[model samples]
Target: MTADISTPSRALDTDSTLPADAAAPASVTFADLGLPATILRAVTDLGFTIPSAIQEKAIPALVSGRDITGVAQTGTGKTAAFGLPMLAALDPSLRRVQALVLTPTRELAMQVAEAIETFAAHVDGLQVVAVYGGSPYQPQQRALRAGAQVVVGTPGRVMDHLERGSLVLDDIRYLVLDEADEMLRMGFAEDVEKIFGQAPTKRQVALFSATMPPQIRRVAAQHLNDPVEIAVTRQSSTVTSVRQTYAVVPFRHKTGALARILATSDADAAIVFTRTRGAAEEVGSALVERGVSAATISGDVAQKDREKIVERLRSGALDVLVATDVAARGLDVDRIGLVVNFDLPGEPEAYVHRIGRTGRAGRTGEAMSFVTPQERGRLRSIERTIRATLEEVEIPSPADVSAHKVRSLLTQVAARQEAGRLSMYQGLVREYVTEHGIDPIELAAALAALAVGDDGPRAREEQERFEAEREQARAARRTADVRGPRREGDRPERSRGVRRDAAGTRYRLSVGHTHGAQPGGIVGALTNEAGLNGSDVGKIDIFPSFSLVDILAPLDADAMDRISRARVAGKPLRIKLDEGAPVSRARTARPTGDRPRGAHGPAGRHDERRTERREWAPRDGAERKPRHRTA
Candidate 1:
């Protein structure tokens, strides 16, 4: 795949020039884009008075049955750009997957489907259903059987239904690939190609992506017929309204640092991006423990409930939303005054999307990224893409946090005064002063403490206690790791083969069982430092003082050095390529009988009996392993 990616237009500043085809009158509305009355009415009802540049140009092309390749960033109303035209062009009477929209994540698929439903709300007898991997099959299957006109789904799950004869596309009139580049990044290129093959040849294709990578351009050139290439990314890479800043936060103290940062920032609400679903939960819980009202949305969360969480975020009921990028798709909230990169995005384009969640309505929003000492390059890449240097900021001091808290308390007091209330509290304060026999000045100080939530102890003291304990724990683990391989309890289901993609390369990493390294930690490090998805990481074998991991390809010296600096289980990875054969033999396998359940003993004390590795030959033309059923 050579770099077939078409160059995007000039800078995206407000005054920047746009593509020749994208020119439109500032007064143009969605109704002026030749959409049918039903969709136009829906647009009006949805408060879409004007058309986005992409929507303006794309709706017309797609309505006329010409292919379109929309190149735009996230939060540019791309969903509406494709959905309006697809809805307007669909013949609702002939219902058998008339239009199929493919998104990268289940959350995005649900978002697109919901928008499609909203756009087609007035269209009579039209049915829409979103199908993805996480949810049960029965509901999606039922929707299809009930004559759904439009089906939106992720690629792998869509492929599943297609293979099972559940989602027939024979009558498919329109095929839309949303976030095509994201799908590729998630390793769904093959599945998307298969889907392209399955869809009807005589169909309109509308493809949109934030980037035009080589693979995407290749796919577009191969599948699209004289496509209208609309590029809307001719503006400043990062928004001018977003004051970008970063802090050098150590990974161990990250949670505490996050608490302090959030406390001191003037943000009304914020979104903290994490690397994985598990990490999202962890960070969210940590924030809650630190007295922040936080919630988490990830692939683990049900589609039905994500709306409520995001609504809370928008309503300012939730102060912080800890989320992974996949789960936070289409999460628009105007009140968000901050965006925190708890974990840097795995891709540069994702960085833009994360920050774009805020600074909406031409309002200034602050974005803060927590960069580890090892992740400077990731920071640099983001700066290169955003075309602006992020201001390096220092972590908030304890005094700063305390001052912010005092300010917040004073603001609350002022609001109460403005409300002209609190007589009940005043009466109580008088009663307390009389009952306790305290001086008026002392009584006033006590009341102030109560208002400021001074729980008769110092907040700094507690934070220091927590930090000291964590440091001690880290030290203890480092000391224990040097002794020998510690017996791993609560281990994952022992599988023989370390699974890797076909093109994956094997690497050996120091600090394995002895260092308390687990597959989860390795996955975390790779996602953070190597910019690789969990799926891109292959088989992992835990050995004494070392481990073997399978990755997509051999990393160059710089990447390998970055991995070496990355920590897993509080130990530096110190990675090196494993030129030796992949550890596929059965001797490397640990069977059930090797150790008693819940057993924990020193390395040399355990028995070394192991299961022989056996060749996994396909039986009677059966598949050795099937493609994963999620895109």
Candidate 2:
């Protein structure tokens, strides 16, 4: 059935129209949708009882060989909606690439590929290959040459394979664009168009996006023939059972802030969402160091390893899973009681999807987002989209963390006591009291301190120190805000501020103006990777080829290594001590202005590039410098 596809600028109501619910009944199952037994068995094994709104509407049309454009949000069973139908129609005996699914990110590609593999499990000889960047190309090339019937990948990597002749679409009968709008947003429009050109003209196409922007609609009009248009709109974007809140945190203190939040939260399990894969690794590692049982999942993580991590989360062996948005797609874990947005999502749709990970199956959940002062606007957009105003909350302080930890330990002790396993420990404690002639209460208190690793005064000192650094970071940001953006003329002013601290150490970074490196991005990279506060970072000089920054002296080898590996403007810092040259002066111009408009081109015209990563962490031995926070 044909339908009028409406765009914001125009409408195509001349064609026939079909009701979205025409085929879907109040009770519709996979069997009712005419899915083959092979696909049905996998669906049943996945424990899916009924189809989702989009799946109910789109499955029949797709399986019937009709091109379709679907409007549905992420996490609404979009994968199964398209995947099951595609699998039902594919020829397993044909070992060529019969189908290609293009996604916006590597994480999404990996997720879609895995889901399709599960759906095609009962269909023998049906091989699915996932290819994306940030991984070795040799393995992907080998997989492509192995006669895989289905290939799922990001547009950039797919183009790379096409140019290299490793992947051929001559026999492609099915082409799907998942999250089409996101691909366009990430500047993959050109790559996507080129892929469309390479695919066979007779292929059946399916395009699904959360929103139908003008560009996407235009593409559909130009390519899709008398297509079926299906839209699944939600009355509300957020789950009512999820208690949502926001915390205002400086970027440099987010890691510490997140640690405190997790320590205090009563959630059975948590998922921390970061915007970039690098941030996921960094945050996951930092959480482990801070004694949180956390693991990371991203595009870079292998599919088999991701399954293991999810299993750990399900079996209660892991308390937290740090992931990028695309990495966590289709991840279902009933115990996820909390979802923390370490970095506010760029899109409100993503915010909804992130929080949806929790509050599932009628269970109440909690979602907390960490927002820098500059991100207050984005936070408002999210509220508008979710149709709920999130209550503002405070990050737990060091004292709060300590108290929570103690409470948790005491609860464990109570459980151990109830289990009646304390006889040996009690006897030992009694002997110690008798030998020392100490009060039983005093001895017990001492043992409890030892058990909890409370080093008396030193523990108090450490807590106080952390609190001080946190406050210092806040104050530095406030001062920077009042002073406004720094200029080349402000270098001397910055120099005076640096000299006030213990002699700062100068470090050089490989990224500079030529790499689109800006001071705010550099500071963010350092604070996030090195776990240093904004206050701890020093003067930044953006030269043409390389930049120099002053940091607190005597950084440990581990911190230095992290800093060296930190990335800014899509390039590693490769940071080192700036002892090579006595530069006369720093660059006079600010690098924060808009890039040459036509040079890199506008938002939609540029080639796909990695979005700049934003985050922070904490470290020691850095002298306080003037600090600034970017939105």
Candidate 3:
């Protein structure tokens, strides 16, 4: 049978107390969705007062056995949307794996399974098990044998279970693919197909995603049977309590800049995000060298070891965890006072996910992204996606750090004085003065100086030197010109998808509108793979069949080589220096022998050379050529 597919077109549910969309029934209690009384009581005991926008719409539809395609952010209570209904529909008498949930990451799988367990906490004879990689297989197999009603797992691990005949989908009445787009990005499309092929043909399919691309739509059309569409269009994904800010630090000065920021901030616990596992370790090591209490985790870390690190972070035993996006998954810490994006996430959704880690549970938090001058364009794209302006802040100088530390010391002294704890110290100072013939005030000043430490002042000279070199780099960037008077390898700027800047040469990317490319995807690929900051990227002008971007800093031999071979939007970009002239309709019918009209030759664009990675992260305000979509 052909599947039924629908696109979500609806208003957002903004009110926390009530449903904001007209379609979703207002004042929806969990009971409104025909949830079993036992399940309702369980969720209520967990302090869930009302159904969220997604939950309000999804629960009722899913409970009625209708396939559903839901579009909502990660934190909008989606787990409950699918979990409660799956529980309600399950027949407790039949204890086989009635429902199977697939996730992209082990962390998400564990989270979903745990939530289902909580919902079924009071339901006797309803067993739930979470199976994922990096854990013992025997225990998972044992749980399956114990007759679990629900099984949640990542795609790869699930496939392994299916191959070994330890797990079967023949009884799967409800099948859910959470974060479906993420799964696709992580290369689970084939595994999903295999799993679906093995499942009961008549089972209900519910695919949930934050964004739906053509690939996801195709999957839905192939599987879902007349799915109901539920979309919650929130203006932004960032939690309202997070304050976003950025600093335009050059690549070379990032370490010093980070030090200054950390010295002045009042964060008790923080997570420093980096682009790669190697970078995570490097950043963590650097932070420790700078005297910050921190640790690092990545995919290379053992599972047991990773869990211990996360536990340490939760209990405040570790002040920070420098991590890649994957490693930070499944981590829930309330004491995270700040989040530092040492490198921007290539995936747009990841930006929201990172900041969402903080400012949770009604607590205020801060997030800062370190931007290079050239990466400003990518930064702007991120801002547009979030629909909020990130306040641009200057890097705190050495003097600034010193002054802040001094204030902190004085504040401590004031607190002690208020508590009457200074009397003992006062007597000690008196004794020192009496014995050494020194002024008591002078002795007190000496003690205060010792407590404050001298690192801030001592580092002043290095800071000044660094600032001078950084300015010189910027100066070179501003004065260098690669534009006119083309060299042999340089093509026309129009075809190259690059713009010449005073600081660096521009190369046009081979992929663009004609190849289904978007600026967000392009920027994400560059920053994620090349380790380039958003500020390092200059203006991005996307055209119907091409794009032009300027790089503010001249990439060295190694950097240029990496970018030339980089792939974006599933296409290897054959980038070359811009030198060819624009193609016009006038050449459409002209003979091959006809002389070229423009100054440049009629030759084509290039001859070769070219993350949690973002497939598409959109930027605001780009001139796009419209195309029609046939339903």
Best candidate according to TM-score: 2
lDDT by residue (314-419, candidate 2, tens digit) is 8899999999865675567788999999988745666777787788766899999998754655677678767789998878876786677777788887778788
Better of 2 and 3 by TM-score: 2
Runs of candidate 1 with Cα error greater than 4 angstroms are 1-27, 71-77, 92-95, 104-111, 114-118, 121-128, 134-139, 179-189, 209-222, 232-234, 237-242, 246-365, 369-381, 391-403, 407-446, 457-631
lDDT of 2: 0.71
lDDT of 3 by residue, 447-471 (tens): 6656656444566676687678768
**TM-scores of the candidates in the order shown:** 0.56, 0.61, 0.52
lDDT per residue (tens digit) for residues 1-631 in model 1:
1111111211111112321212234666665689899887766543345566677678888888899998885545577788888888788887677889998766566656766776786899999998875456789899998899999987766876887789888888899899887776654676789898988888999999988989899999999999999987533366667898997665777888888888888888888998767688999988888778999987556544776787677666788999876566545567788999998775565677678767766688999999764455567767876678999877775656766777777778777898987899889988987898889888766666666566555866865776675466457446634643212221222333443333256677876556766555565456545545444555565665666666754467767776787666657899876654323322356664464333222232122112111111112222222121110
Clashes of each: 11, 5, 25
Superpose all Cα atoms of candidate 3 onto the true structure and report the RMSD in Å to 1 decimal. Answer: 11.7
RMSD of each candidate relative to the true structure:
13.6, 12.3, 11.7
Clashes of 2: 5
lDDT of 1 at 303: 46
Worst 10 residues of 2 by lDDT: 7-16
- Please report the TM-score between candidate 2 and the true structure: 0.61
